[model samples]
Target: MSVAIPIFKPVSQMQLTPGSTVTIPDVTWEEFESILQELGEKRASRIAYNQGNLEIMVPLPEHEISKDLISDIVKILLKAKGIKYQPFGSTTFKKQGTAGVEADACFYIQNYQQMIGKRRLQPDDPPPDLAIETDVTSKTTLGAYEAIGVPELWIFDSGKLAIYLLKDGKYIKSEQSPYFEDIAITQIIPDTVERSWQVGSFQALEEFANLYLSIIE
Candidate 1:
């Protein structure tokens, strides 16, 4: 007897316009791993897998801009608060026989010490304290993050930022982030990010930093 193998179209043949997405259903975990291997780490696409469904998305320019702005804002706030953090940009996180997701940006805050000098995430290691997603191309599904047990998830869409906190093995919407509860992050971040589109990222970030300094001082 001979084993039959499934054939997949080459990634290069897929015409994914910016802000577009493709979903493949009933993908096995092994096949998902094979697809990841095929895609490689240098690609510009982001992927999410839940159960047997796989999603591939190409972000638009607006999405990239928003992701960068929000990540920068997070770094500024962490620095101003004297908090140590390790940023992981678009790193693929996976759990065996379960789910996988690539965050637009992620950070190890309370667990920063654990991640120091670490190159790849181990199964026993803690997931990121915060994960960010920009929904310019497609809406983010909570299944993967929920399965991965990420503590905090932020989704920027339609000029607004929505925060989700994992509690009791599930996610719940919250107005304040547990890490930055003292500040109105949901409001300030979105406003500043939108302001960046008008005045350029450098000036907007500088202003945000100065404002934050004034508040803490």
Candidate 2:
């Protein structure tokens, strides 16, 4: 699954026609590689002290679910369908242009590996087909994925989910999957946002998936 990244990229690529509005910094691929290496080393150190739990850095939020009930409920339902899932993992690409980005939760019908210039994420590497993000950080991080070419992006912020699918070199709102074809937010996200008036509306999403699944099957 390929997607657009929000970074400044060279207009030299024929397909990526230069836009008078956008200007990419002319940094060699070597510079990006070195930056990744340094960041990985420092982040890896902090990750070492923490085990079992996922933490990229001490101050940064851990790979956490704001709603554990919703997380567990959704995973259980998806697993029943035999779906493969991974959370917050990096996927790098090949050749001179590449990037390594981690997502909050990603779904894959199948998995792939990461191949960097001097490094690789081996057979055990998991590159997800669909990635979800909790947009607490600057929206700029979203562009990083666009630049690196992630196919699907689901951003949840302030209790709303904004989804995008890469189409024709840009990310646009999409309700359906181009890769899975049948998969959509409703299939991946629990419909808890619709039922149980006992809980506030914002909190209802936790019940949507579980309730919908029970009704369907």
Cα lDDT tens digits, model 2, 1-217, are 9998788433232132221122224434565454445455423212110011111322223224433333454465566565655433333332224333455455554542232232544434434556665533433345555655667776665555667887675688876655434445544443343232347434565455444556435
Worst-scoring 10-residue span by lDDT in model 1: 135-144
> What is the Cα-based lDDT of residue 3 in candidate 1?
100
Per-residue CA lDDT of candidate 1, range 42-152, in tens?
Answer: 888889988988899999998999899999989888887888999988888887878999999999998999999998878898889999998833333588888889999
Which candidate has the highest lDDT of all? 1
Work out the TM-score per prediction.
Answer: 0.93, 0.52
Native-to-model Cα distance after best TM-score fit, residue 76 in candidate 2, in Å: 3.0
- For model 2 the TM-score comes to 0.52
Error of 1 at 149 (Å): 0.4
Candidate number achieving the greatest TM-score relative to the actual structure: 1
lDDT of 1 at 11: 62
Instruction: State in Å the error of residue 51, model 1.
Output: 0.5
Candidate 1 local lDDT, residue 167: 95
